[model samples]
Target: MNIPDIWRGLTRSRLFWPVLTLVALAILNVVVAPNFFSIQVKDGHLFGSIIDILRNGAPTILVALGMTLVIATRGIDLSVGAIVAISGALACTIIADAPDGNNPGTVVFAVAVSLVFSLVLGSWNGLLVSVFGIQPIIATLILMTAGRGIAMLITEGQIITVSSAPYKVIGAGYWFGLPASIVIAGIMFAIAALFTRRTALGLLIESVGINPEASRLAGIRSRGIIWTVYVFSAVCAAIAGLMISSNVTAADANSAGLYIEMDAILAVVIGGTSLAGGRYSLTGSLIGAFVIQTLTTTVYTIGIAPEITLVFKALVVIAVCLLQSPVVQARMHRRKAAPPLPPVPSGTITTPVAAETAGVAS
Candidate 1:
């Protein structure tokens, strides 16, 4: 019934605009592009731009899933990127030192060690935020600043080349005609989804996010949950690091997982999670990751300078965020939320006979 209300409703609809945007982008690609949907097999390998996105973006999606949980509790893990760097370095060091054709044990040993360190790092961040009352950003920032340095120290400032097939399989191997990263990401997503669904952790996270004081007063161990999520985020980063190293058959401490946590944060935001906390949607985050990767591929294919993608994507995300904000949503809901007109003044009701008489007279 009102212009402002209609406009706000349009902006606030979570599914409507995000879906429309995705469709519009696809349409644009189809119209102004060459075979955007076509897949090709060449040299005993499958090739497609879409497949490339699925392969390359899976790790980001996986990391973003963990980030979504962390942010759902109004927390951030700035050290995820660093964890990736360190994990890759750890893996490569083992493989590099292993004798020729003796990589199986080394790979397992390295993964175990890397996971242990990630767990500790995550626990440290969690303890700082939970027990010491440090802000999530501040706590993780301390690690972020030191993590890369630690990674470099692990690698001795040199990129370590690893020629292990098992390690490489994480990045380059295929299963069911898809990249291994895709499969691993899928498994992680399913497990996360199941854990959150089957347990009360999801509700606990939301309660803490919505009202931490209330959750604590209700006897919930909010701090423990917070700690668990930070550790989970570190584990995700480590897995991503392995995928990165496996793809290239080498680990570069300085380059692997560089600025990836930023990408993951952007993804969580784009997926409709409030930065202020209380709710999260992993499916949406997965979609957001795909959207990001699609844009990257499109930029490369369209001959647009790769550097422009950061600016372009940033602007697009900003626009989406503004549209998804409470201001816009509240405005949109007004028309729907307004009370229906009163049937008639209680004393002004007319009988059916009177209605018939009035009709006859008319």
Candidate 2:
């Protein structure tokens, strides 16, 4: 392809700008801290700032992955944060009360119960939106508001801590020379990508997102598709909850996964998925999650005030959103393509009277 063609392709690619932003951030990080990208092996496991970012970012990545699918179907799950809290609360509460919380069987049982509860919560959301015709935001908001209270009740308004070594391994341990959380996130992404692409699921979701009525008329079970996505999103949130609670070995109902939904949504937007719905990219969302984590780390490395770190995040998000905006892009194109005013003859520069008369005629 010619230079202009290649340029156009690069500009049009959805992943291009986010990727560019991520690379820029990484470069800045390296500049600020020379060892930013350095990974070292200790006890047969990889450890480094970059590795920690991936491991810590894993939960957000998981949530964003599911959010991509839900957004692609013109839906949002505001309750994900609450679901995360509930998952952690339930599991930790269960494990804490067990005679031997560290037993593999106890941990497994607690995990199973948490997942099942999450599925039920997901079904509740699906029923409201798909069957009751409620708006996605409002429907999920119900749980968002109520879920924390439920979690508090589950833990009796106390933080539930556990001593399960097996459970701790899930979020804090290493596997195959990598963080287990990172491994889990990678596996989840792979599964989602393969499941949607290898089947007709992805197309159906896009169709529903583009136009639910049209998809229904076209013989697609749009309701079922929509319902399934909500459930899927919940499961993703539950798994993230496990990772989060595992990391700390405690479940604080009031604060676990707080404001996480916002981050997940932001990641989805940064990844090129529209709030309006339709197409999505899991890969982009994964990268967006890492971008967010890296930004947070960079803030700390630069010694920025913790309170003002959010302002930096806000600025970066605004920049990304503006860069992706079609209106901004179109205006830029117009400015570039507009011709410079024709050069007037230097010796015959118009007098004020002549210039005023020409302007009036125009």
Candidate 3:
């Protein structure tokens, strides 16, 4: 209702700092590029820096959404990037090998195959962790290392290209005057939000994440939940891979979705989700994805050297993490709550000895 109350409410919100960072980055972009916020109609489609941020950041957002769930269940998927590469590589290879790459049926078949293969890859990770008792990180890292090689083999160590108009629409076309990628991301976000929030799935996930042994004791199907999250994460990465390859009409196995797992993990962390597991925020991950994209855009817009861009990004991320740290927040609150020194009376004037005596007595 008032300034202090509003401040308190904002500080209490998990999304407060991430939203603020996004706003600050947007303001910075506006200052650097006068037309940064300006959107215009181009060929009946919206075009602008903001649109580009959403469109380009869509894949990361998708990956982050799934990562949020996996992290909530006390797990991580380092194989997401590899899955991304494999998805794109497989899809492009399928289309390229087809006699009619542009045929809608062929495109659909390729997409289906890519997604199905991604499921298998995801199941592999799940099997290692949920069934075989391997650590999530180690289980995923195995695929992370081997996925690119698999993708390379799929493409025969070459970039696979295709010209399927229908497939291209998935990533590069416009839908209802908005980028198709944005639409797809939005739809997936809604599905994830609703699927978890509208059902008991969210509570079960939090329960499992909080204490898996306890959950299993209570008959909560902990293993199934863990396996499901990994599978879901893999599917998300596959869809992202499809969008990326579709956008460029080509798939470079070596370069596709490189280091994207890092971005997705960063997004989940920046969204205020703890790596320790339990409790999560999809909305926060969405904002964090934008934050990452905005930061990347800022680096290029500010003309930072290529070699220094990573350093600059690291600095900003470190600052943000520190600000979000509980220790830092507690210190800030203490300073805010500390009482001010009592003001001296208007006519009061004390000699040095008197002041010293008063100070000592107090």
lDDT of 3 by residue, 64-89 (tens): 99999999999999999999999999
Assess every candidate by TM-score: 0.87, 0.92, 0.92
List candidate 3 segments past 4 Å from native: 335-362
Best by lDDT: 3
Clash pairs, candidate 2, are: none
Q: For model 3, where is the 10-residue window of minimal lDDT? A: 329-338
Worst ten in a row by lDDT for model 1:
13-22
Can you tell me which runs of candidate 1 are displaced by over 4 Å? 1-13, 41-46, 331-362
Better of 1 and 3 by TM-score: 3
Look at candidate 1 and tell me the lDDT of residue 15. Answer: 54
- Against the true structure, candidate 2 has what lDDT? 0.92
lDDT measured at residue 292 in model 3 versus the true structure, 0 to 100: 91
Candidate 1 per-residue lDDT, tens place, 1-362, comes to: 68876766566655555555566666667766768878887665567866787899987987898899999999998999999999999888877877762467777888889889999999999999989999999999999989999999989999999788877878888877778899999999998888887789888988888888899999999999899999899999999988988899877888888888888998888788888889788877887777777767666766777768888778777877776787866664655557787688764628998778878988
lDDT of 2 by residue, 113-212 (tens): 9999999999999999999999999999999999999999999999898888999998999889999999999999999999898899998999999999
Worst lDDT 10-window in candidate 2: 329-338
Clashes of each: 2, 0, 0
